[model samples]
Target: MIRAYAAHEPGGKLEPFEYEPGSLGDEEVDIKVEYCGICHSDLSMLKNDWGMTQYPFVPGHEVVGVVEAVGSKVKNLQIGQKVGLGWYSRSCMTCEFCMSGNHNLCQDAEGTIVGRYGGFAEKVRAHQGWVIPLPEGVNPVTAGPLFCGGITVFNPIVQFNIKPTDQVGVIGIGGLGHMALGFLRAWGCEITAFSTSPDKEAEAKALGATHFVNSRDPEALKALTNSFDVILSTVNADLDWPTYIKLLRPQGRLHLVGVIPNPLSVPIFPMILGQKSVSASPLGSPTTIAQMLNFAGRHHLEPIVEFFPLEQVNEALERLQSNKARYRIILKMDH
Candidate 1:
């Protein structure tokens, strides 16, 4: 029996739980989770916000661990290898998207926590293809978010073919936005940060933002009209969509990685007149994820994180719910 923390009901406290995972599948690997990052998606699943939560739910997807066991058919990974798993646990290998190396977009993809138990346990199982090897020089403790939040923001850069000379803007200087700033800077782009917190100006700059625009100030936002080559929105809150659209230069793009619950009402006139575009994407595929990890390793880029023991998961959840996490929170396995 593998020990884990699970909530039997939505909005209930997570407590001790155990489960017996039967025989592993041929393509599956058992990972001994060392550090699991608590993401907002975990909170959403706990509350059944997306209406897809299954009770006795173990809510963790951002995981860094060592491969403890591999099924007979598993290749390309070996026992004792350190790897990270993200929101996805499996994708149908025969799908068109999977064949094209866009496995993250597979329609039949299996979420790590959507229905099945997730990495909040002492050990988790996933298809070998969904488990990415961590590059040398990346810290496993802080690398967990890269699997989820990091890849969410990084995927668009590759998909859009964003240029190194491009001027990029990142909204919300929190978990995802902070990582976007670091990656955009390391990619050699000029970075601008759109934040409501004036106190975060310096911190955002330290995180690789070359400019900080207080989104709370209409004048500050108005002055940046048609300035960005790409603006990456990483905030879940509702934003002034038209204003953001106005800030895009001709042929510029506004990409969303954040999960904004409401339908965005954008001004079509501006997009049409300027030939601007709007797009969004989920986490990257295994290949793109590997590229992100390699880039992070080469640049020594990492997420700013707070640590909590796995047993204190409820407390960590509360912190995340209260919006008190500095950037990201990692649950360290105490067992």
Candidate 2:
């Protein structure tokens, strides 16, 4: 049996719960969860905002734990090995995408918290493939968010082959944007932070931004026209899309890691004339995740986080829902 905190209905408080996990599959590995990060997606699932959340929901995907057990066919990881799991738990290894090292794009991928229990528990199970070993020297206490939020922003850097010399702009310096500022700064790019909150200018620069632009200022934005090589939007809220599009240089890319609720209204003429492009991506693949972890470990790049005990799960959720989290929230499990 796995002991966990779960909500029985939409917008319900998480309470102590237990369930029988049945038999472990041949390729499955059971993780003894140590710490789990609370992501915005978890809150969305808790409220059934996406219309796909299962009841008796356990919402955590940024998992840092140890391998308690592995099935007969598992080979790469051993019991007692420290590891992490992110948004995905399983993907069909036989798919072309998986074979090509892009398993995150597999058509039949399983989310850690989608139809199954996740890391907000004493134990959680995932296929061996999705279990990533922590690179040597990586701090596990604050490493949880790197698996989800960290990777969400890092994947695009790899996908787009963003260069160190590139001029990059990051929009919305909250959970995702803050991390982007850190990574892009370490990647050797000159980063400009775009946020409506002028108060965050000091924090943004402290996180790696070389310049801060109040996104609400029209003059500030217009002055940077055709200046950026890449602009990463990390906020879900819709904004002045056409103006941002114009900020891109010729052949520049405007990439989105945030899930905007509405369709984008982009100016077609400018994009055609400037050869600018718009694109979006999900989390990185297992291989890319490993690379990201290694880079973070080398740079000591960890999310600015607040810690909460697993028993205080509801309070942590409330903090996140109220937009009071400094950057990320992690739930420490009592062993």
How many collisions per candidate? 0, 0
Model 1, 26-137: lDDT tens per residue? 9999999999999999999999999999989999999999999999999999999999999999999999999999999999999999889998999999999999999998
lDDT (Cα, 0-100) at 241 in candidate 2: 93
How many pairs of residues in model 1 come into backbone collision? Answer: 0
Q: TM-score of the candidate numbered 2?
A: 0.99
Error of 2 at 41 (Å): 0.4
What lDDT tens digits, residue by residue, belong to model 2 across residues 1-335?
89999999999999999999999999999999999999999998999989999989999999999999999999999999999999999999999999999999999999999999989999999999999999987899999999999999999999999999999999999999989998998899999999999999999999999999999999999999999999999998999999999999999999998989899989899999999999999998999999999999998899999999999999999999999999999999999
Highest lDDT: which candidate? 2
Scored against the true structure, residue 63 in model 1 reaches a CA lDDT of 95
Identify the runs in model 2 with alpha carbons over 4 angstroms from their true place: none
